[model samples]
Target: MTDALSDLARAHGVATAYTTDRGHRVDVTPDTLVAVLAACGVDAGTERAARAALEAHRSERAARLLPPCVLVRVPVGDGSGGRGASDRRAGRRGGPQDPGGTDTTPPLYLPEHTHAAVQLEHGGTVPLSPGLPPGHHTLHVRTPDGRQACAPLLAVPERLPAPARRTWGFLVQLYSVLSRRSWGMGDLGDLAELASWSGRELGAGFVQLGPLHAVEPGALPDPSPYRPSSRRFADPMHVRVEAVPEYAYLDASARPAVERLVERARQLNDSVLSGSSLIDREAVLDLKRRALRAVHDVPLSPGRAAAFAAYTEREGQGLTDHATWCALADVYGGAWRSWPAELRDPRSPAVARAREELAEAVDHHRWLAWITDEQLAAAQAAAVGAGMPVGLVHDLAVGVAPEGADAWALQRCLATGMSVGAPPDDFNPRGQDWGQPPWRPDALAAEGYRPFAELLRAGLRHAGALRVDHVMGLSRLWWVPEGRPPTEGTYVGYDRDAMLGVLALEAYRAGAGVIGEDLGTVEDGMREELAARGMLGTSVQRFEYLGGSTGRHGPLPPDQWRADCLATLTTHDLPTTAAWLSGEHVELRARLGLLTRPEAAEKAAAAAERDGWLAELARLGLLPDPGGEVAALHRFLRLTPARMLGVWLPDATGDRRPQNLPGTATVHPNWRLPVADARGRPVPLEELPRTALLRTLADVFADLEEESPHDPHDTDRAPDDTTENANANETEERHGRPGSC
Candidate 1:
């Protein structure tokens, strides 16, 4: 451990905080042996054999950095190196779970060769069993007999199957869909009217929408839908432009000036649905860019101009260098990294003489990505014709805006001097960054994983379930780089077996279901290798916790969850759910001074405002106890059972507020506001089930009648490309009814 204290514990990037004078933490997280024996001036009792060689170089660096150590390349046995020192001391005294007593030299086992408890092995790459069935097999590691190790192709596990019960669902976010004919943002015709009102009314097995890619459209743009401008296209301000069927053959006397600009954009979406407020996305992209340039001057069909010139020649040259940098930012403007160097080369000849002096601004950004892919295939065919069963779900985001247009057309598989983020912990005690830019995991596995599998096959072609965001970035990603300070940054490891084998071969070729926003601070066994590959694991009911092994708690139920998850309570960067039951995120984090300790943040905000009014009087049974205040926090957040939940439509109308607020984005106003409606105002999704803030959020999911994991696409899409029309207000007589605490 003295290569200058293992290079000062690999320069402060592994601190799990040790030091009761060393080697005894069964509970891991001893801030990397007390910040590497407090940076080599040594202690841990005279560096207990340099803290047992810094716990055998952090147990051979968490078994060469964990995640079923990619099944230790299950190439059975080729002792290029591993399993030598006396059968790694007899599987380190035969594994009864080595509670930080420390081991692993030439060893790796889970339930022996993986049901994924944990393994980390790095190079010589073998790890077969993703459900194995490829070809030859065998991977024994020790007890002599000349050593067995063989492998041919490996991927057999019943030949990459699962994740396709119509790719599980539900995960909202497209600027919290302010619908009812949205123009003030929220489009693709209000995500095809919330997938035809979540498939008829909620048998909704799918509909996850956030990052409809394409952004930097201005009028207060940067509302951060993961800073786009071409994640292979879409964000034509969520194009609806009078629900373009080429605006019903225009020119009927130029249709009463586009019917008085669609009745002045339906009186500005009825003043943002009677002042629930905010919606003005540059006055709905200046009235749908004057109704899609007056219905693109009425002519296209020569087979829609050869399918928009074969989608501009199969989106060649990164959508023709981002439609020639939005036609040289409409006449040499908006920072093409501050243009003029051959107008920032989108294939220069001065960006092809500014695309032949702006061919109507590159045909209005290629007819705004063909009317945002014809309103995202008519909002996933109105969420599978509105009977529902997994209709939309899209998200994706995690990194993109180093001067957008997918960081200037995938700047050669990006990473330009780093910038991902998050390190200072105990939940952001400062460390955050998120300036966007990462992805050079060896130039996305030397582009074999074709630009992250063609941006996960263009968000599963109009998706019916995707979500991802930071699904622990497939496994490891802190990065930082660009002039450091996300606590001087580190953790870079990616290739989680070619990022979950390019997300199980693009959700098994785009039928679509993936999820992953696996919440914050994840490290140990990455939720058991994304639950042994069926990939679904986010919990959220305000961070559940009854202390581990998933039980003794309430919200932790739903069959200890992971059957390919979506389960929710609140996300779009937390807080809503009426500001987590009204202490208004503890008085907006103590009025943004972000409480360090003004008397333990005012006694943990007066005991979390008296346990949220005794969990709302134990959900109105008028609590035999909790008298002073503790409103049965939604009867203890609808007593667990989470396979899916996510109510946060501004916390189903109570709307306390918190789209985002990491570390004072200039005293806040982050992602600018708007989902309101119960007097705070902004409500729109066509006046939420005729408001009372969506009938007190459909009487709190009709008194938690359960069933919302929104099943179907647990990871690889297509349940029946949205089997169309069903939600005749479904909750099947208010959730599978059974009742209890």
Candidate 2:
């Protein structure tokens, strides 16, 4: 690539070259660069276009007195110690003589004697300075050269709020954890019951669930929560119809149909628990929708009506847009790209007319959103009421489906002809196209990151802590051009400071903690930065080996683990603890033809790893003469100084199947299995408390908590504090689950 083109790419936050996980520097091709630039609304098809774009970019920067947005760091003590990378990006750090504040690192770019004031998010205006309070504020500035500008100003906390008490929680795939009360699959009622039982009866701290975002409305909508129709709204399919307030008020005409639907749902639930079928989301949705519509026909009480109105008003246009999309999808299909050109644009007059024509349908969808939100709030309330310090940790997926509600509604802010994905790496030599549209960085800045902030707000609304999937996307993402292989994608950078600042601000507002899934190929300093901002990182116990060879290396000792993370034995996409110990994962992979190596070799490697873990457990005295490997693993996790520990809910029942298998699509029944026991018998939520293994795992955590309380002082200890030499060959695993096909 020519220097001008390279410079233009850099200016636009497009990578010209990047280092692979294997340490090889692969230069992005000129064609790839141009295609990516085009996605970002820049024309770089030729040298002339590249030179012109670069000059224009430079000129724009030169003319701007204030950036599109400004980030203000609110310190720890008196708001002076919360400096972050945003400060450094703004301008050079000033010394003691600086006029802003004691910890004001980033000074303004305004000329000397410039006047500035900030309008806080809540209310009131104040002069822009170090004393500016934490909020999503607006900055009004007048430079000495007679230039004036305004920008979004974020004064965010340096770090997120830490968990009040070091505690252990259950990490669950909600759909898989069906209860007797569920309508075939797990619902919010099931979630509430689990949280209440675990928190009060089992002494658990929280329940971390997989993404519960709304899925597309269709017969065979993608089952993966990681790929959702709208992140802003909770999935209505997860709503417990029996729990709706209006259910009891159904008139005589509707009561019989509702009762029949309930009976049919009961049968469906029985089928799943009997292993006669997978969790049928489509059937469940159909049953619930009919029952919910019948309930919707019933007159709402005055109080309930007011509450629903307040919710719709608070949600504002986001909910309206989502409901409108659903209404349109019911007619034109889920993929808005195929919709009539006039109707595709959300803001067009045609949509306004359609929205009016389908007002009742829109209202029904809106009602669905409201009811889902109500259930989510109820679940969190139950957790907190049951004494969970960090009540519910909600998962936020990286991006929304390209053909879903969010993509249709926020078309202007998302890249039109690009998808978010991973570049070619060791684990995935072919790379992956996730088919989720990425946010346009330039558009995000131009729009003051309203969409991003809204997403965080929605996720954190009922969450005691929010777990961000692919958190590295906050800084950058691999952008694959339309119809191109993922291997041809290049990295596109986001304003890291602004992204983190907004997250911190929203999280702080909600009084919630943040956990970043910082696995896979993380950028240097990414973990440290997340830690600095009070965001926790994820650490899977099985992957935290000190070295490569199973016999020569040992599991990372408890004390060696990072204190600022949610340490667990495994995640949804990985093998369960029982499966890993028995080498079932290897066998399953071989059965599915997903193994690149011979089955024998893979099994041998898995066995070696299991034996190594057993040896470590025995050495640490965690393994008794007849102790269970699953309990021993929990005991090991308890020893880690990590602020929070996660017990995969399926592990409590010795489930061997993974909630998701990364590589295979239809060949493997991913995201459709119910939580089953060792013999593959589906275990209901009601049976969970009586299970000997579940109680045993609970005892493991309870015993440790009673024996030794966590020291808040040790919460932020670095993972390398122990004496073990962690010089393991860093072959990064594929970090996240693939987007649902």
Q: Which model scores highest in lDDT?
A: 2
lDDT for each residue of candidate 2 in 1-741, tens digit (9 for 90 to 100)? 899999888777788888877779889999999998898889999999999999998898777777666766776452226553232233221111111111212455566677777788888987766666677778777766788888877777766655556888899989999998888999999999999999999899889998999888786556778889888898899999989999988899889999999999999999999999999889998999889989888887899999999999999999999999999999988889999999999999999999999999999999999999999999999999998888899999999989999999999999989998887776788877888999888788777778999999999999999999988888888889989999899888877767887888898889898999977767666777787777888888767877521223677777777777898999888899999988899989898888888898998988988988888888999877244889988888888778889999889998998888886657888889999999899999999989988988888788434433344345474435332233234337545555633
Q: Count backbone clashes in candidate 1.
A: 95
Among the numbered candidates, top TM-score falls to 2
Estimate the lDDT of model 1.
0.53
Stretches of model 2 off by over 4 angstroms after superposition: 76-80, 84-107, 547-552, 703-731
lDDT of 1 by residue, 1-741 (tens): 234344334322222322111123222223333432332233343445555656665565464322221222211122212221121221111111111112222343323332211111222333333323222223334223333332112121211233323222345566556666665556777767766764556444566666778766554445556666566677676777767767788988788897888788887776666664555566777787777778888887688788778877765656667777776766655556776676654655666776787887787787777668767877887777775545676777776777766776676666665666655543443456677766654345434446666677777776755767667655555555565466655454454544664565566456555667765555556555665555666665555433321211222332333344555566666666655555567677777777766845665754664464455445556465332112234333334334444555666556667766554546765555667743577766766666544443333444233334333334574322111111110111110000000
lDDT of each: 0.53, 0.82
Least lDDT summed over 10 consecutive residues: which range in candidate 2? 93-102
Residue pair clashes in candidate 2:
75-79, 75-81, 75-82, 159-533, 160-534
